[model samples]
Target: MAQRFGGKYSPSGQKPEKGTPSAGPMNTARVTPVGLRANLMFVPAGVLLLSSVFSGAGAMALGLIGAGVWTGGAVMLREGLKAEAAYNDRKVARRPALPRKILAAVLAAVGAALAALSAGSEPLLTPLYALAVGGLHLAAFGMDPLKNKGTEGLDAFQSSRVARIVDEAEAHLASMADAVKRARDRQVEARVEQFQATVRTMARTVEEDPRDLTAARKYLTVYLLGARDATVKFADIYARSQDAQARADYLALLDDLQSNFATKTETLLIEDRSDLGIEIDVLRERLEREGVHLDRNL
Candidate 1:
């Protein structure tokens, strides 16, 4: 049969590849050949010829043998495209494709060889002919396991082993994520401790020297600013927080601070630092603000 299976058509309305939804009649959009099964006909064809040589192969074998060449060619072309796609896909990802492409290439070569044998004129060729075809098919199929791209033959034992490895890796990642969260929590605690220290320092300054309201007031400002920073951090961590009591406590504290920060400290002659964006140190103003009074016990 004179059959032209694949040919390029630059003419208008010609489908670019097979398997395309827009391809016109005859599934012309399907790529010429691209897939694992592309040249798979060699497998059955070689089996047919080899079996026929020994035990008078049945009609099934004959049918498979007749279509072997074209089938293999078609499959190889398609799968070869698949291999190409795999290769192109790795350009940006840097993913290695030696395993899969090698497997696919091995299969393609077997199919090509089987198709090549068809050119010969013989109902059943010499022993080597069928043996070559059969041997190659066996080798090509063997590529699946040898390449280790797919675990088709892995027994239950091997499957369990792989599963264990995956589980262990996931556990390790989870542990690391937990450790990061703990460290972050610790940092927040440190900030809270520092702010509390500033408040205590403010109180002590007033006790040490009743007239040193300037130093005491500066310390209070520091405490307020520190508290504002802590509030922001708490908001970040507690976004979707479900703890009712904790949420209430934080909200109450925020409201109290916001109220205090909005008003000016009469004796200090300055707005509370928390209500403002940043602290500005004014030596003259600090010394002049005598109206501010800090009681150590308060």
Candidate 2:
């Protein structure tokens, strides 16, 4: 499959053959192996690979070995077939090298090699078997923890539409700042500058990882906290301005707060959390302390 540009997939740039139909793979980070390939190949292959136990004398040991070989072989064939099918389907120019297939092929080939090597020294096959089996078990167990370390759910959502969101967000910030500056009021201009700086920080953080979105989230927390502070400071200075301009500055403070909240909403689209409540409470308390009452919902 074609790789994502940002945090999402796009199979958009393609022309299927006249008689061909395209069934794209799940275009997300958490893609499950699906269709027949997953059921027959991935499931069985895993079971068989884990069945490699060599502790018994004859019958049990032989059975376990047979089970392992059967499952491993089947998985390799099935997954390999899946790859071949993908190639045939024109969905992928090359098949992905799943770890299970490589492991199975290695184990099978190594078994043959060890058998030949231990021909005269039959007793030596015991250590060889234990080593191969134990090594694969360790390898399999290690894969999950390592792969799960990246930003959660971000891979599916980042490249979702890079150019569009990036442009939209930046343009919105610029447009709003222009609106403030064009009003030709010093207090409004000052608040707008503070707001734009926070936005720039958020944008920089989001763009840092087109592949990983957690960084963007971190930036948002910083941005919101800073925004909350700015609102309080603006409210304090509001009493000093003339009546109409003071209300304008308060309205401008609301505008800045709105921008912060909107940015947070966009960030939350790719990440989910409950940390926003604390920031809201902080903003509310500061607003009340400054005697600048305003509805803080949305």
lDDT of 2 by residue, 82-185 (tens): 44443333311222436544555465544433333323336656567646754654454222111222234444446444323544554555455545443455
For candidate 1, write residues 1-298 as lDDT tens digits: 8954553454444453321122234321124324345445545556545544553335434434544543544454455455444334221111233444344444434443443444433545534555565465445443322232233443545434433332343243233233324334433333333333333333332322333344344334454544544555455555445444544455455445433533323332332333232433343346459665444353
Worst 10 residues of 1 by lDDT: 86-95
In model 2, which range of ten residues has the least summed lDDT?
141-150
Give the top-scoring candidate (TM-score). Answer: 2
Could you give the C-alpha RMSD of every candidate to the true structure, in order shown?
Answer: 28.7, 23.9
TM-score for each of the candidates: 0.19, 0.25
Give the per-residue Cα lDDT of candidate 2 at 282: 83
